[model samples]
Target: MHLLIITREWPGYVLGGISHHICNLYNEVVDKGHEITVITGTCPQSSHELTGKKPPANEVHTVQFGYRKGYYVLFPIALRNYLQSFDFDPFDACITHTGVPFELPLPTVSKRHDCYEATKEYIRNGLSFLETIGDRLMGPFRTIVDRRSIAAADCLIYNSAVCRAGWESAYNITTPSIVSHNGIDTSVFYPDSGYNKEDYILFVGGSERKGLSHVISFARQTKEDVIIVGPDEVNSPHVDALGRLSSDELRQVYTNAAVTIHPAGWEAFGNVILESVACGTPVVATKNCGAVEVLPSSACVVTSEIERGVMKAKNLNSEDCIKAASKQTWDKPAQDMIDIVRSITNPEC
Candidate 1:
């Protein structure tokens, strides 16, 4: 099957978990005997992609311009010239990650990675008057595109059930939504990997919705050595800001962590939890994410039940956690996705 995958960010242009998903899913899906064409922005190398890998697969296409700060900056006009060079034929189907505007022929499937509705809580909880104004100016355009993106898709796939439900509530659109949980590469992240396990608790947040402030507050109160990895670093004594980690470095962080902390109030699917578990590490996550359904009985300790949860996580065996984490591989989810595309593109096939 020929698949065209669209993402806002790609491996070298990492912005969030969606970047990892797009990279891994495309690689795995293409490896599994399907032809894939990836469309993403071109940016500086992220800490995620390892140093000298082969060039991208034959079908991948990188669009060079992207939004930065509060504006869209076009790359060299030649990049646009390059973008115009390619002609897209009707594909078997196209699967797009949330937040990119890519048109496709035949059955189109959009994967919602996070719930913008939950992110709205961040804006409403308290944004400065200036931030509010800027957001309000941008609101109309975002809403129009978001609605069209979902509605235009032949099918909508969400990383978590919470995300799907949120879309339903927001748009009143009852599209077909499958709970396609995010996955981790167990080969890269496992207990035996050489990671320097530190004494501090770990927190990985890609966006504002991960509740970084809450994690900082908890760390400050407990005075625990806290390592926070993300793009934006909130200044706090309790936090050791790693800023951003490359893909390999991130796996090491997961391998060496004492306990992974996720204070996200509302998340679609928490990939950090899965990555941590793949490293034979336990996680302290909120009960809200869709991935919580995939947690081992012992590896997850809910934030609402902090004390008892911490105790349970400490007691969870590394071997058991690894065993449980092994179930959701890139292949299985990609296969599930392929099946969805087949059903939609050719019901009679």
Candidate 2:
């Protein structure tokens, strides 16, 4: 099968949730003996992101997109204009970042990683007063785009059930959809001796939306070390900040920590939850996190009581966490996607 995948946020450039999903999914699909053509936008590399890989030669097409911050609103228009002159007849199907303004003849799957509703929670995290007001004023426009993106696709693939449900509640969407949660880069993250049965607690989050308040509560109560990853700084004496780590570095952190706490209140799906457990560290997340759907109480606990939850989860059998994570590898989602596409393209298979 030949697949045409389009995204403005590609991995190895912009490091985020969607990029990891695309990179891992694309690799797994390629290994399954399928051809892929990727279309992407710009995300300049930094010193720490580890360059040397780009979109595959001849298979990738790039458009000089100008508004990086406004990509969500502007990218669809850019893609629509670009696709007007291009021929997509050769590809069997296409998967887009979220949605295209115009529909394609081939089977179209929009990767609804999250909905606009998710952005509203940023106000609680760190959005400035102006930004919050702007978000409020832009509600109508955002709704239009959201509805179009879903309507334009033949199907929508949500990264989590929470995300899917959010979209349903926000838009009352009748679009055909399926939940396909994300997977981790198993090459860099797996059960290892990185922890060596250590006693430090780990918290990975970039902003307050990732349960920063809850992390502070955990840090204040626990006498153990609290290692923080992603935030620029945390003034607490109990916290040690490791701002922005590479995948390998992060895997070590996940491994070394006695438990990784990700009490994200606004999360659709917590990839860190999967990554932590995959590295033999149990996680403490909330019921709001969609990834908890696959994890057991021994591997993850869904509660707001950070201290007790960590106590319940920290010493869970490593094998159980590993077993749960093993089932959600890139290969699993890739195969699920292929099956979805086949079901759509070949109804009688």
Candidate 3:
């Protein structure tokens, strides 16, 4: 089957869980004997040519739309024309990884990464009424565009039950939705990485939405050695501030740390939770995180209650944690996605 994947970004081209998800899906789908072509946008500073590790010299081509860097919300005329002019021929199915050109004839699927209803909550953490109003006024335009794109799809794929619930509640469009969780590369995120175990808690920070403040507060109250690695280290004593480690480096952090922490109120699916468990590191995270689906009771202490999490982290069992993480891998979920795409295109099989 010929598949046209329309996404906002690609793996090496963009950074985030969404890109990781797309790369895994693309790799697995192409391996399973299907022609895959990816169409995505680029920043103003980015090279005009699409670049990434090619897969098996197969029939997969990437169509890059814009330059390297610019305002993320607006689309350039060139990008708009390039996207709108995409021919719906020679493809059995089309999947919009993010909002792009709205109209497509083939059996279309749009994966909803995060529901805007809940995302607004995170955005309005401590904003005043006027500030909140300003954000809300600006936010719904994007939401409308997303709604139009997903509403046009034959199927909508969600990463977690929480996100699915939010979509149902927010949009009232519940036609053929499925919860296909994200996958992790077990080979890379495994338990025995041979790194010196650091006697400190590790918190991978993101901006406000990721609840870095929560991690900082928890660390300060407990006075535990906490190393943070991500976009920013927001004022914490034990923070090492690695500031965006490579995938390999992340695995190292997972193996060496005493515990991995994720406190975000709204996460579609927390891949870090799975990475931590795969590295034989127990996670002290909120039950609300999408990783709760894959996380074993023995592997993680799932609660927002601070004392419970701290206590659980202090007494995590390594064998149990490793056992739990063993269930998740890149292969299974990747295959599941392939099956879904196949099912959409070939309903007879």
Residue 179, model 2: lDDT of 91
> What is the Cα-based TM-score of model 2?
0.93
Least lDDT summed over 10 consecutive residues: which range in candidate 1?
69-78
Please write out the lDDT profile of model 3 over residues 226-252, one tens digit for every residue: 788885545656456778887678888
Across residues 131-212, which tens digit of lDDT does each residue of candidate 1 receive?
7887777677667667767677878887777778777777777667687787878777777545556666888984556777
lDDT of 3 at 158: 87
lDDT head-to-head 1 vs 2, winner: 2
Indicate which candidate wins on TM-score: 2
Which ranges of candidate 1 are over 4 A from the true structure? 42-56, 64-66, 69-86, 98-103, 123-129, 193-199, 206-208, 231-234
- Give the clashing residue pairs of candidate 1, or none: 47-246, 47-247, 48-246, 48-247
C-alpha lDDT values of all predictions:
0.70, 0.78, 0.71
In candidate 2, stretches whose alpha carbon ends up further than 4 angstroms from where it belongs are 43-58
lDDT of 3 at 166: 73
TM-score of 1: 0.83
Collision pairs in model 3: 43-67, 43-68, 43-69, 44-68, 44-69, 45-68, 45-69, 46-68
Which rank order by lDDT, best down to worst? 2, 3, 1
Question: How far does residue 73 in candidate 3 sit from its true spot (Å)?
Answer: 5.7
